[model samples]
Target: MAINLVKGQKIDLTKGRSSLSSIMVGLGWDPVETKKSGGFLSGLLGGGGGGADIDCDASVIMLDENGKLKGKENLIYFGNKKSKDGSVVHSGDNLTGEGEGDDETINVDLKRISPSIHRLVFVVNIYNARQKKQDFGMIQNAFIRLVDNQSKEELVHYNLTENYAGKMSLIPGELYRQGNEWKFSAVGEGTMDADIGSIANKYA
Candidate 1:
């Protein structure tokens, strides 16, 4: 069974697993239902009534030993789907959180990551949140998980259950290196960041 994690918890990803090198990280969320449902009323409401689709873009900001971005190309999202070194790859943008399970996924090759890069911070932000007047308050069942890419088995799962009403972005979790091993931290922190670029600035 996969370990269910709470906010602030951390887990070791490559401690004893000698052969483990690649892993799949999945992120998912759903929009909360509104009683209004569709039409001009829903559009004006931003969501639920279905005025506009809540485009939550998942991104990974690669950082160095000093906890800072080394280059602009290290940031991976819908526009830039893969890392320059080819160690990390994003599945692509999920325009709408309309379906079940992992709306977006990012695959990481532990062995392929550059030695200088020490952290992979996973973030999710509502696209044009301020313009659309949307936030996590219109979202539900947000989660981040890791799977053993080779065996297709889930190793860790973190369901973010927080009241992020006015929040526009989330730093769900991150993978950082400790010596030769990688560790996963369940960081369920919400932010008022307007987009992925704003979220990446904190580490810049």
Candidate 2:
């Protein structure tokens, strides 16, 4: 059975696996039917956008052992869809979370990631949450998971439920180096940052 993680939980992705090289990190969600379904958070974070489609964007911020950003190109998202060294790649933007399955994916070649890099933080934010006054309270079934892309084996996954109401951004989880092996953590953290740029500054 696949490991189902709760908030603050952690798991080892390379525990028994010898070759856990390529991984596909996925983030998904469904737009809220109406702000009324959530509550006060909807009032606090909703806008006069008049129920337009929500555009949530998924991104990755690569940090060194010191928690400092490695470089600009390391911020993978819609515009800069791929990392400079070609180790990490984003599958482009997902304007609306209308379809099934993951809305966005970050394909990582752990073997090709820079030796200096020690952590990869997975983040998600509504494309224009600030302008639209939207938040995670307006999204449903939001989750982040890591899978061995080659074997199609799911290593770990976490789904955000009712806790992220007023937040516009989420730090769902992270993949970091533990000794010579790698591990995944279920962070499931919500933030007030309205855009990806602001969230990116935290690591910069």
Candidate 3:
């Protein structure tokens, strides 16, 4: 069974489980539905009339021991699907959050991560949100989860239930190293950061 987490909660990832080397981080969301005939959902369903379909892009930032970015190649997203070291890989962008399950996923190899890397921050942002007039408030049922890659067993899950009105970016969760072990934390925080570059600049 997976442990459902609340905001600010943290759990051990590879402490007791010596065999846990790789894991998958999944993020998902859906566009808010409206009663009107044509809207975002309609656009996604192939009908036309609503505002443009929401394009939410999921990304990961790999930080060093100081919790800061050391290189540009450490950022993983649709354009850059994998880390230079191959420790982290992204599943690519999801133009519409119309799916039933995870819209995007990032795979992490614990043993392959460099010793200097200490944190993996999972984030999601609206593509061209400022122009498309989209935000998290327009999205619903957003969640992030961690799963055992080999066993395909979910380990931790967090549902972001807060109202992120006018927020273009979300920091769903993070994985950080403590000594030689890794842990997961449910961040569930929202920000107005426009794009991945602006968000990464904060740590750079």
Candidate 4:
């Protein structure tokens, strides 16, 4: 089961084995360039003729009890890196305008993780293309959500729409146990031209 988490809650991860069922990590932003093919010359010059586009990847890292990167083999991925037979562990990249399915999902097998695992770290990266110059101008409405497996409840929702000038690190807040449920929330928002490590020092 998953426990509901608010702004400032805590959970003791040393006890039960609450596996992660599903994760929805989303990146939303307004396109600074939205013109989509003005002319061949504009394209050649690399001007603002291309339409709005967002290319990014999201990742979640599970940490051991001592807050270290120990076991990563059990980490799951969705979008563009699911499985060989197309099982869709990680969802495909969403290149269109930001919308409902503009996010990636990663499913984890809780049974594989050690009971001492204490925290989860999420990282997002913006891909750079030839035609488009990556911009960190204005990113809005980005967050991470943890959902329960059995009960299908929204365990935690982390808001990361603030602090645009610098990278944000979201420490899990409001994690606790309610009967058989355990959950937490840690959301952050930011704009970057390259990888997720450019912002969060932890990833670097």
Which tens-of-lDDT digit does each residue in 80-152 have in candidate 3? 9999989999988889989699999999999999888999999999999888777887888999999999999
RMSD of each: 3.0, 2.6, 3.6, 7.5
For each candidate, give its TM-score against the true structure: 0.93, 0.91, 0.92, 0.55
Model 4, residue 124: C-alpha shift (Å): 1.7
What shift in Å separates residue 167 of candidate 1 from its native position after superposition? 0.5
Local distance difference test, each candidate = 0.91, 0.84, 0.90, 0.44
Q: What would the per-residue lDDT of candidate 2 be over residues 1-204, giving only the tens digit for each residue?
A: 579999898888887888888999989998766546356544544543335688998999988899988678878888898887788999988888888999999999998888888999999988777777677777879998788988898877889875587798999999999887888888889999988889888888
Off by over 4 Å in 4: 1-50, 71-89, 129-136, 163-181, 187-193, 196-204
Cα lDDT of model 4 by residue, 1-204, tens digit: 444444444544324543553334343344334434566434432465544565655555555555555433323333235422221145555554366533655554344334655555555655653234443332345555655445555555555545443332223232222334544544343443355344333432
The TM-score of predicted model 1 comes to 0.93
Instruction: Show pairs that collide, candidate 2.
Output: none
| lDDT score of residue 192 within candidate 1 | 95
Q: Native-vs-model 2 lDDT? A: 0.84
Query: What is the Å distance of residue 12 in model 3 from its true position?
Result: 0.4
Deviating ranges (above 4 Å) for candidate 3:
37-51
Clash number for candidate 2? 0
Model 3 worst lDDT window (10 residues): 43-52
